[model samples]
Target chain A: MKILLYIILVTILLATSSARYGVVAQQSKVREYRIANEHRILEEFVTLLSIPNVASDHVNIRRNAALIIEMMRRRGLEPRLLEAGNSVPPAIYGEWKVPGATRTIILYAHYDGQPTDPKQWAGTMPWQPTLRSAALEAGGTILSMPKPGEKIDPEWRLYARSASDDKAGVMAILTAVDALKAQGIAPTSNVKFFFEGEEEAGSSHLGDIIRDQKLLEADAWLICDGPVHQSGLKQVVFGVRGDTNVDLTVYGAKRPLHSGHYGNWSPNPGLILAKLLSSMKDEAGRVTIAGWYDDVAPLGETERRAIEEAPHYDNELKTQLGLARTENAGKSLLELINEPSLNINGMSSGDVGALARNVIPTTASAVLDLRLVKGT
Target chain B: MKILLYIILVTILLATSSARYGVVAQQSKVREYRIANEHRILEEFVTLLSIPNVASDHVNIRRNAALIIEMMRRRGLEPRLLEAGNSVPPAIYGEWKVPGATRTIILYAHYDGQPTDPKQWAGTMPWQPTLRSAALEAGGTILSMPKPGEKIDPEWRLYARSASDDKAGVMAILTAVDALKAQGIAPTSNVKFFFEGEEEAGSSHLGDIIRDQKLLEADAWLICDGPVHQSGLKQVVFGVRGDTNVDLTVYGAKRPLHSGHYGNWSPNPGLILAKLLSSMKDEAGRVTIAGWYDDVAPLGETERRAIEEAPHYDNELKTQLGLARTENAGKSLLELINEPSLNINGMSSGDVGALARNVIPTTASAVLDLRLVKGT
Candidate 1:
């Protein structure tokens, strides 16, 4: 149960469509090797998923790291936590040294997840991983835990906070290591595992931990994050855009005032915010803020060529997202993402809907997410 | 105490600077008549203010009406409830017929107040009116209710939901009657009182009640609402601007998505809202929307002359409100108020401040207040 839960559920989720659907037409190596031992991997994955892993959740985050450490211990990998501070989410580190391996590579993944309002998730909680017969949008049905002899459908999805994120990356890499040892395959390279606890939290302490810990040294590192491709094919991302957040606030009168009494006189914070935010973007969705796009580096020939060669799925994506249009007018999604971008993640002022009142709010605030390309 | 509480406080609040502060230099009619009976009026005002009188709160709204009904009964005026519907806030109606009166005037005011969020009120609750030595922004000190014989500070300010709004209007009109009876003065007008319970809620049922109740007949409806001139002088306003509210909302992807993953590819609702709202107003804060100002009636020579003659206190108001700028670049406050105006009372999308997350919200909304001049 432990073996199959850890190996099959999470690891199989993000595998290429070829690997995922190959079982229906013909048995893949994973099916052949684990056909009789499927329940073990399913159980191990479920147990690990049970722990809450929001980066901001100090207690539950540590609990998740502890469980990963124990899992590494059972596999004869001496895992140690590399932390910059007691409160910071630690980076769990371990390595397998091959007898005559010359190349050293580090497999990197984050155990932490984006902060979530649990109410946003439907039919499930962030930590309470559940198996669905299909995607929720496609009319999925919840399924109970399969007994040892029960059939496990490969198309069934596990819905949870970190299901498709780097948590699945952690399990996939670990399972790969397990498969190598089980097949008595000798390693061609020295393998090191580094599981980060705060990638979703901006990885603020990641550099500090890497600088402090000597064991994290590697010739090359492959970060397992983000998505594959919209076509369900695997794509190795070379570099990710840098991210930063800005919290902007504007003020009105010292107190909430009747809009009718002061509508033409008092400056409303919400109107001020709208004007200010609008000033940052033009009609074509290009940021109008001064110096916004001035610092971004130009894309090189090789990088531009790679983007041109990538799949063109903007039209398909727009249809799926129910959007008749997207930002940056003529630019494709691939090309647009390569440049620096600004997006308003959230905004708030006074109240709306049921609690709406005819009064000018005291203040208005917005959370802006800025994504940067190279050199930006 | 009973007589003073109802008369001195609310009646004196908006009675011009002369009536409010004339006691030290010269005793006004209100002060001279209510000197020994001051606490009675205050207690009554505070007790009425204590009731939750938001129009939407049906249960508490009726409680407010019942209290007002009893207050009128004790004053020897016959009061009756005028309701168009069962759930609608009832209008408290009463009248006094002076035998030799020629002019008949309906003293119109609203008892219901703007919906309040308690968190916005500082150092006090909306329903718990408190005595303050000065305005809250002026570092006012909270004071206990003055005893009957104790001196009442004519300058002291009362803080609560409807303390300065139409509720104060209700008490003022009623107290004027009390003052007449106590002083044995015969009023020259047949006075009628129509205290509406939902003016702040747009008075949807106001026309309905007035049409149905034959007792509401009067030569003129003197609406005891809004404020005095900015110079703290009484100004008899002729006609008021009409008001309407629009709840505007924009949609995004059906669910919240990780901004870093989908930001550039997906359109953000907040940015959409910002751009949309900004299009409705220009840099000079003039409405840019098509036909927004086309229907507004042109001001006549009399109205324009009145605006020109009004005291110019824009600079003083700006300094007091901590504003370095005002809307409609060249327009004065008096001139702007005479025209139509649009204000964003509140706006919201996802969360801000502490609960802010790195997710693209599913929707963004704003409450727009449109105040129209005559013919609009």
Candidate 2:
């Protein structure tokens, strides 16, 4: 009993000491400020998410930009719209200059989201910003937004099309600035905000926007996109894989033929596409295309070490994902991510389930997304 | 000029001799009858095609049965409905008894058609029975129905869901009877007409109906359904492949995940399914499954000779289909059809084209059709 007490006392003393100095001290201060204004931050986020912001939706996308500008203006930062030309969704730009700061950090986030079919969404609509007790897949129930005096649960998720993808990034960055101001904490570096409006449309005008805006130049860029780690842990990804999409279509007959009458005689486009795709990748998940891996650059020492040091959570992930086995049996996920990959974003031929008919479709199509590493 | 005249005279004489004693003589009588009452026959066919005869639509299916019964009665034959139980779609039965005949032949056709989606139909509605100059795929234009004095083109096609499938069978059979009676030609065999109302629903109660109806017994059954030969030549199929459908689905994460964040890490269901299906067949279009071809019955000497004697129109077919190559490279389509085959009737994973989102879908599914030969 005496030893246990002693151990507890030592733990408390060490924690208290760490709270007074080091990264823990800074984190504690940020947390306190965030907790104090969590409700307001969440409400603002909900409002932002309620806007329909598909990149190709010109009217709604402009609305998103206007609202984001208002969000920056409320913080006393003068925001401007950066556009390539007329009718294009503009980038919202703002900056906070710190006196005596030697570096300028550009914070990047996108406002537009991927196009979604309304019929594909579950009970909630894409732009409705429905709050759920948890994830919908986890039997989450919709909850009414909290009133002014009510406390909120951090675990509750706001369900919307871009709730997690990029709107969350914008919300988090803006909230972090609010927290710093509320706590009277000064940032060591000048921060510039660059909220993009057409990332989902492949950022076609991003180069022009950057080239035309001279003030956007910074020492380094901190991009806030993607999701939290699959293990629900915070992670920092230094480099992102470059993406290229290819739309592939295979042809069968000129018209759909009854499967029973001409199945074997007619070439099935779906099977042809499958065979073509299979030829590109082997059973071990390695791509077999000629010259596919030839141009890949060797990993640097730092990258190699980082991969080796990363957690070995494949077993835990497999259990959570309900997978008995993964492709490329023995390779770790950290090891796999560093390599180039060929993934099928979407594939279709005829129809399945209730809409399925016994017809050999005229064409089968697949959208393949190739994620390139540093070299290829 | 004298030599040309002599050649023409010889050609005319030979053609007349062949028409008098060859297959043309048998076809000439049917042709004369069809040509005499073409307008009425076409109008009757259009009226029958106008009825929605999806087997599941009980009211429409019964209406089809009643109309068919009326048609048989008009020809002075006794007609009745054969049913297993109440509320089920019944088979329309009618018979023409030939005195002193040693054989009875049953002419089988179905009134019910495959369920159709109105939106999937081109130009014409499922039961509207519109006339077209050609197939919709061949850029056919909708044409007005012929008036009493208007000349009808034999090449013109009637467009409806079941226009050519089985309704055409019903119309042709009845018209043949009319032609025979008008020409004072008697059929040697006692002809029995059996029109099923639920063929598209797998003829679930056909066995029961046959067992309950004593007059259904016949020495021969001539089934009139399916398409004309791909070569547009009259052909008969002696045996049909037994069909079995298997639905296959592969799993990914429990919910959709951003492809950018977890693409390489998360096993994509589409890719997994593609790999699985690819494993079933080789590059040469031969199934690699352990027992896929093991149980296939070998073709007899007669069947082999028949296949060899069939017209080799594969080159013309390939050109029409815009195919540079076919599966099982050197083998003829006739040889391939004799073997049991596997085909993907339909497959789906997420959405393609504009509706496609950058997410790894939860599941990918495929409808696989396996065509079986004897002993398989």
Predicted structure with the largest DockQ when compared to the true one: 1
Give per-residue CA lDDT, model 1, range A1-376, as digits (tens). Answer: 2222333333333232445465343235555656655567668777888888888789999999999999888887789999888899999999888887888878788898877778867878888889999889889899998887998886788887787776877776676666556867545778788999998888999889988878877787877666756665546667878899899999887777666667767778887898898888876788888898888899999999999998888888778777877877688888887888888978988788767887777899998889998888
- For candidate 1 chain A, which ten residues in a row score worst on lDDT? A1-10
Highest-scoring model, TM-score: 2
Q: Over the stretch B82-170, how does candidate 1's per-residue lDDT look in tens digits?
A: 98898999999998889988878777888899887798678999999899998788898999988767898767889888887867877
Q: What are the Cα lDDT values of the candidates? A: 0.78, 0.78
Which CAPRI quality tier does the interface of model 2 achieve? acceptable
DockQ (Cα-based) for each candidate: 0.55, 0.46
Clashes of 2: 0
Quote model 2's TM-score: 0.88
lDDT of 2 by residue, A153-234 (tens): 7677778878877887787777777766765766777888899999888888999999988999899887777555556555
Q: Which ten contiguous residues of candidate 2 chain B have the minimum total lDDT?
A: B1-10
Second chain of candidate 1: TM-score? Answer: 0.91
